[model samples]
Target: MTHVQDGGPAYWRVAIVEDHRLQRLRTEELVGRQPGLRVVRSCETLDELMAWMAGGSPQSLPHVVVLDLVVDRGRDADPAVVERLVRSGMRVLVLSAMASVPLVRAMIRAGVTGFVGKRDTEEDIVAALWAVLRRRQWITPELASVMAGDAQRPRLSDQEERALVLYASGLTLDAVAVALGVKRDTVKKYLERVKTKYADVGRPVRTKIDLNREAIRDGLMTASTVENDRR
Candidate 1:
């Protein structure tokens, strides 16, 4: 773990994956100007970034990955790629135009540490990177309300709520089961019930990511809580 002392620089290696040439260059420039931050790699696609990572030494891996959710003429961002990046021990910050609740929830569940809208100011981008680097979660205030749609929030049974909190906290099925003092299969059953309950209220939780969003909305978990669980 590296730390800054005596007001000195704290270097953070960052990578960018954006398809648009102009946007990529602009983002690179913006990131370069930030204190204590460096743009280690800027590529047009996640594949290109992954290929570069494969050829480089582990020490060269970026501490943070700034990715676009939808890249023109390239593979769009997917949860699998986010999961892959998280599994590789890199903090991910999604900078995307798509700020829909579903998309934001999906990325969060996939383990991104922060999200910033494409329309956000350059300062917002820098702040997001700083938050993720500190193991915190950053979502703009507007998106935060979208994630917490209280008026349409669904109700959950005690068991279902417990299951959601445990699962969304990054616990495996077996581990959730152990915590709930139930069998692994029972944990799955509880999760299924929870899913149906959400769908009943017109809030579809079709995947693990959706369930994770619901957990956050239900006050069962926070983004920082999920990040901590992942760590």
Candidate 2:
């Protein structure tokens, strides 16, 4: 277990968090090939990773966690654990094929530093990580296309997005405030803005579920057109 002291030659301690076994292995292979990265863990879920962390396991709990959005059996990552990782000084890079525009917006609001699609080639994934390690935000071109799909897409503001994901993912406003590093009143204000935005569309956005369904139906994300972005 190599402890990467803060001032090294940009080498990274990385963990791959994907539910699929094959995908996890592939990610590990790609990370292994990259010059400055060490693949310390290849975990199948947040639970396993957390358990390893609890055991004081030194080979994992890396500086960078490459995450997949969907968990097995449709389980999602725990918002609390996500916050713990970020607060405990881990950088999270979402490496998912299931990223909708709303999801991407949500993650950004949650303070994720990087978002890369699983459809990307190994080289692209590596480059994305490099960008994040250098303290730059990186979103895969596919996700960029999702943003471009709706010229009038009234997506959530960063604050609103965080609030919405937390709300949609079953967190109370207070919990959202804690997770987002914001205040409860701030969460309320964002919710108010959310209501206003949806009201403009002749419907109200009362829950995260509503926003996600609408975002998909409106082609804001469903028509992501990843090929267009890569080309």
Candidate 3:
């Protein structure tokens, strides 16, 4: 949770992991220009960054990591990666276009130091990094309010979230399996896990109708979906 400052270097070493090529380059330039902050690496994926770290240099250690919350179009970066960075004594600051409440909550639960929306101003983005380096939690007002309002919402895994969205959108188990490239029984287990999590959080979803209702309430369903087909 803490960034080791003393005896490290003259400036803070930062690593950027973003999916978009242009954004990654821009961020690397931005962070490198800041006083007392140096961008050690700008990687397109967490795996790439991990590979760089594995190559091993005394300077390979990063004091802070800025990662896109979801990469490759709605696919969330594994929370286990976040935990690994935090345990290695790196402060993680999420920089993303923003995603669903459940996914964002899942990342927060994984021990992120801050979250910043892509639409935010450059100054605020820099501010978030400094705040995170100072061992303080930073989040945009909009995200903070959203998280606070849904503070009791259950954190769903990537597969569980996908299952909820698909099933709640009127897809049958077989159809969901096809979309997810998994077996029908695998899709069913995903739904079952989602239901258990929801129940654990005091929102019991005992039927498809109930699942649809909960999905809508959690912003997983689009506004056009006012009602699911009763068939």
Candidate 3 Cα lDDT to native: 0.79
Model 2, stretches more than 4 Å misplaced? Answer: 1-10, 57-60, 99-101, 154-231
What is the number of backbone collisions in each predicted candidate, taken in the order shown? 0, 0, 0
Pairs clashing within candidate 1: none
RMSD in angstroms, all models?
8.7, 9.0, 11.0
Maximum-TM-score candidate:
1
Tens digits of per-residue lDDT for model 3 on 86-149?
Answer: 7666898999977766667656645675899989998999999989988788989888776656
- Model 1 C-alpha lDDT per residue in residues 97-154, reported as the tens digit of each score: 8645565555665667588988889889888988888867787776666655666676
- In Å, residue 18's CA in model 1 sits off its true spot by 0.8
Residue 198, model 2, lDDT:
68
Model 3: how far residue 33 lies from native, Å? 1.5
